[model samples]
Target: MKGEPRLAELIASLSLATDLGLGLPQEHVLRQTVIAMRLAEAAGLDHAAQADTFYVSLLAWVGCIADSHELSRWFGDDRQIRADSYQVDKVGLPMMRLMLTHVGADAPPLRRITTIGRFLTGGFRDAVDGFVAHCQTTGDVADRLGMNARVKVALSQAFERWDGKGVPGTAGGEQIEAVMRVVQIADDAEVFCSTGGPDAAGVMLRSRRGSEFDPALVATCLAHSERIFSGLHEVDAWSLVIEACPDLDRPVRLAELDQMLEIFADYADLKSPWYLGHSRAVSALADAAAVEMSCSAADRALVRRAGLVHRLGATGVSTSIWNKPGRLSAAEQERVRQVPYFTERILSRQPTLAGIGSIAGMAFERSDGTGYPRGLRAAAIPVPARILAAAAAYQDLAEERPTRPALPFPQRRAALLADVDAGRLDAAAARAVLAAAGHAVGRRTRLVAGLTAREAEVLELLVRGLANKQIAARLSVTPRTVATHIEHVFTKTGVSTRGAAAMFALRHGLVDAGGTSAERPM
Candidate 1:
């Protein structure tokens, strides 16, 4: 965290998020990478091949994010499907049954039936396409991170199997990349061994030899299964993986670190379509707000970095919950609340990212003692954290969600102010966010329909069907003040009922059809 951060530290930290997405135990990827390294050495792979194996093992499932929305549409929980996928060779009827069984598993009976029917007709083809996208996306990610061509090539072969039954089904037998073959064994070996011990791991490898695994590599792994897995449970996988980084020139300079964090943001946002650019939006807003608030350069960097990775924890939750249209059950809400906790845990694994994680974990912490995970109060939160919280709150409103359409620019500002009034946000932080978002703050700006700025704000919320008290809470004003504003808006707009007021607002183009005015953060 003090000097330049090494690439190993960053990738190892990212593996934690990968583990959550895979629904495997926390160090599953690290352990799999360890197994891969051992398998590489035992199989007499060259130094370069061994390195590729290590990287491919870590990144094997990273592409799962690219099609998670589709996965959730086809399968009830993408993570659960991924976790259970290890139970069998995903080819032929086994693959078909897996899809058939899980399609809309959590939905109502009628919906599930319809989903299964649709999947049988053409959805299966779409799922296969998803796999192709996954392969392309994983390769692109490796290429973007400056990985060598061997690493990217090997990763692109991720879904290939020994029997030519994997997605795309184009590569089979020895046609599959050797490095990928080694990782295939290590990946399943880690899962089986962890769940069933070394013998179970051996059984899986031998059983799938020449079908799901490379026959020669499986034989090698089976020969020394005990030696390969020895101390796996006892050793620190994180430390071991870090030590296994192949390059001596691993430290990433500041600019490189920024790019890596942005990748992290994209990785998290890719979990669901609704969140495609949420993290970057938050990061940009927070950085701009920090400048507006006159924060130190260090604080600005910290807050911005924190914003970029704030939703890393979203990987731990199922896309079903994230993409749900209706209200969440209490249990679902509890799981959602734990997202920031998971984000902190994932980032805290690497020293370079730990500080950012600490601030990012407080994304949901309220000013008054009303947030989640740890619920720290206003005094407990630092200035950077306050700014980050406010930025995240505002940006979230700017994005459309399954439950509601994107709030117009004016309503977003009003919502921030309401949070400030409710003691859930720092007033200055909220004001800075407003200003950074292109709003003119602390000024009596005139508006449409001969309405004052305050009346316009009140009118926007009212058009959205908010009650007077709700509007007051959003604007941080009293219900009486809200009533007064509404009355003035009615007098100015010549409308008495909420319906008429809404029609007028729409007619006047007060509602912004577009999302936010700020450019997306680069």
Candidate 2:
């Protein structure tokens, strides 16, 4: 609703921490952007190009996580691969060595053999080429968001090298956009500084001059290295970078901003062939379900918006887990759970986006309080969140995961309904969800003591161990209402205690055994 351009808003959002599986501080991206912008100014670029360079620098590595699946698929841990990527200069030799070493690092022999065979069959080649596609896709998103053509062009060539060894390999030196050159140096400079401070970054520029980086720009960075980097450690990177955004010739509006974010989300999802259209699918599904459930238009829009960014937290999880063909360990599962939280952290910055963030943050939460990062009980959750969570779950089920095939319609329906019966989802909301997912709801016998849809839901939660207060919070009802629902459930189900209710629900297709049906002890 704010008058700010969505492009600016996105930049503000992306300027948050890298979330690269390391517990690094937030604003890592913003700090890098600041360094890149200052380096551009030092390089004597014109005001227009500098502005273009500013955004390019901020978003240059925004797509870094796109190839994470591939990296993790071939290598054991995607974050380690990225950490190592920063240390290498030439792409080919280092990559070959890294690939050979990591081929079967943590996998079984057969799995490793399969990965190696695939890599030899051009999988590695495609993975490398993905970098270029990432740039093009990123630039395309910027173009769609109404950014100037110069910025788009600069972003498109962001991965190009001076020696013509980069993706697309078409532009170099003067042919490459000036912003691209500035951003390239800025990108490496941040890594070097993080490794060895400003002096190391300067050395890296000097070392790569005329090969990986523009010699002139490197010299410019070297000349003003001290002044450009002065006090970089002092100011908050996000605020400084945001304040330094070259004021656009014209202010951007909210609609334009949303379009821009959609583009970015789409591009981010395109990093891997598997993720090609996942974000758009989730967004559409979430929005459709929200409308089908008769949610307010504003709430519907919020769900759609949250869907676009629900996977932004995917940046924090290692791509290895995302693309692995085997099961994830407990540690890996915990890492995966952090993604929704990461999305929340990024969106929570802008107050206007608070509702969107709140929904996005709970995309992984279940009504039974079994979802990660927070095991919120039924009454503690929100309806919008419940819908978002269900939509996301259904979408993921429809997609191919690392360790499983896409769920068939019948299986997907049964699984979803099981969650509904298990107190992990709202019954009315689940019915709406099933309909949205194209499932027919024929007349069937009541599953739990002839409980109505709402009553079944209350019973499911009661079995799950949610206290009246927590149930009220999740259902957006008062504790007294929840108590009344519980009393009715007891009378109807002939249950005397929560334990008995849980047994009856579980036995009668009302709950799952994942302990997800039961709320954790308060």
Candidate 3:
């Protein structure tokens, strides 16, 4: 584990994409992280407080994607609204004005009026709760990544204002954590300076000194003046922040890998309530289908992890498109297509996770080569990749979408077969995935040559590309036990080596499960 990557590295890799979701350039979060460090020093925050400030600044806005679906539901261009919002203080009348301007800017008159009517009802309450959700979810991610207790608690209060006017305000003034106060200024200051230079940033912070920001911290930042505000444009933002990461970026426990991947799954699904369990469901099906296809244990886990993070790019796409009630224009359709590519680019930055990203990026490829991002042909795709693509399509077809209701399972199942017939999915991969979906599942009901029914099962898994060790793991047996079974299978079936045994099984129809239609999808 000496060269293994740390969890912070994973979080840092996603910092750029988080900025894109906020409608800022990739380095927005990184620059703010550096600025927060400077503010922490000037405020005389202790070592412990400084470390908390580092992560709090980097992740403050990373959870912005969680409200995208709801935000787009209430505002046509959620991304643009957020981008404009950074230009003003989010407290009191300015926040109300911002909401009024964006609520129905592009909607029809009737729709706009109805939106206002709903806003008067309970929609106002929901909007305030969205900020609470942001703070809660961000803390959840930090917790999942094993951050310190102080970081998690301060993060949960990130939106609490000095004047106690913020979401779920439980404390204010000095009671508000210093790290949150420092980050609030750093977060807004970066936006003003990057877009309007230091003078505009200075003026903006000065105006909100006590109401929206801690006055002392704001003064400290302004005092540093040239040291903190200058050269932001000249420095290498990404490398600087990575180097400045808190000293807690140590190697993760191997057992924590799935938990880390689950963090990605949770973060991606947070884009909308509609995506509630979308990634987890797909990951489960893909894992089961990998087992059905006898994919190696390593490959099975990899494919499942791919299913979880395949939608990482969904962060960059607006919820306007994801929650649209009707068809999309060509331009909108093109935007939806880049999601997987974004996922790949983000994951590829961390070398340890590059394999998962490689496979996850192909979750939409077609056998006929009509998929977006890359039109990979059938033979060009691997079995695990093909299973993932098929599984995701199946699940999406069975789930509700913005433009349509959930298709009946019969109809969804028919659509999957149609894709196989139309060359969009491989036949064997389709059947195996269908079996995983409970289409026609059963062990070999008959013997092959002189082999027992169970011996035939082992041979089928072998032919489908499992190694002895993987097969043993899947069966909960030792490799030596599997070796004994394989020898008996070879002698009984008049075959040696895995390929020949597989051919014999296929030729004899033992691997195809001729006895039962229950799970024989083909």
In order, the Cα lDDT scores of the candidates are 0.81, 0.68, 0.76
**TM-score head-to-head 1 vs 3, winner:** 1
- Name the lDDT value of residue 220 in candidate 2: 86
The order by descending TM-score is: 1, 3, 2
State the lDDT of candidate 1 residue by residue for 380-429, as single tens digits: 99999999999999988887677887788889988999999999999999
Where does model 2 exceed 4 Å of error?
1-6, 15-26, 65-70, 91-95, 108-124, 249-252, 256-258, 271-276, 408-410, 439-522
lDDT of 3 by residue, 1-522 (tens): 753567676777667668767877767888898889988988899988988898888788776765565577678777787788887788778887888778877889999988978875866675776676566557556766778888877887778888888878898898888998999999999999998898889999999989889999989999996788879989987677767777777776655776677667756655644454577678878898888888998889889989988888887778777767678999899988998888887787567678888889999999999986899998888888898999889878756665666667678779999999999998887777778877534443567578886677677666443567877777788999888888899889765544344334433446431121121100
- Report lDDT (Cα) of residue 165, candidate 2: 81
Better of 2 and 3 by lDDT: 3
lDDT of 2 by residue, 1-522 (tens): 453444555666765534343224466667677877888777777888778877777666665554454455567676676666666675688767766766767778888888788788876775665575456445544545567777777777867889788777888778998788877877777777876889898877877899888898888888888877777768877667667778773455655545655654554453333454466667767777887899998788878888777777776766556655667789888888888888788877666555677888888888888886798977987887788788878777776554566778888889888988899887766676778878423333256566777777777566444567877777788998888888888788765444345434533555422212233222
- Worst 10-residue lDDT window for candidate 2 reads 513-522
TM-score of each: 0.84, 0.75, 0.79
Please say which candidate is ahead in TM-score: 1 or 2.
1
Per-residue lDDT value at 313 in model 3: 83
Between prediction 2 and prediction 3, the one with superior TM-score is 3
Stretches off by above 4 angstroms in model 1 are 439-522
What RMSD does model 3 have? Answer: 15.8
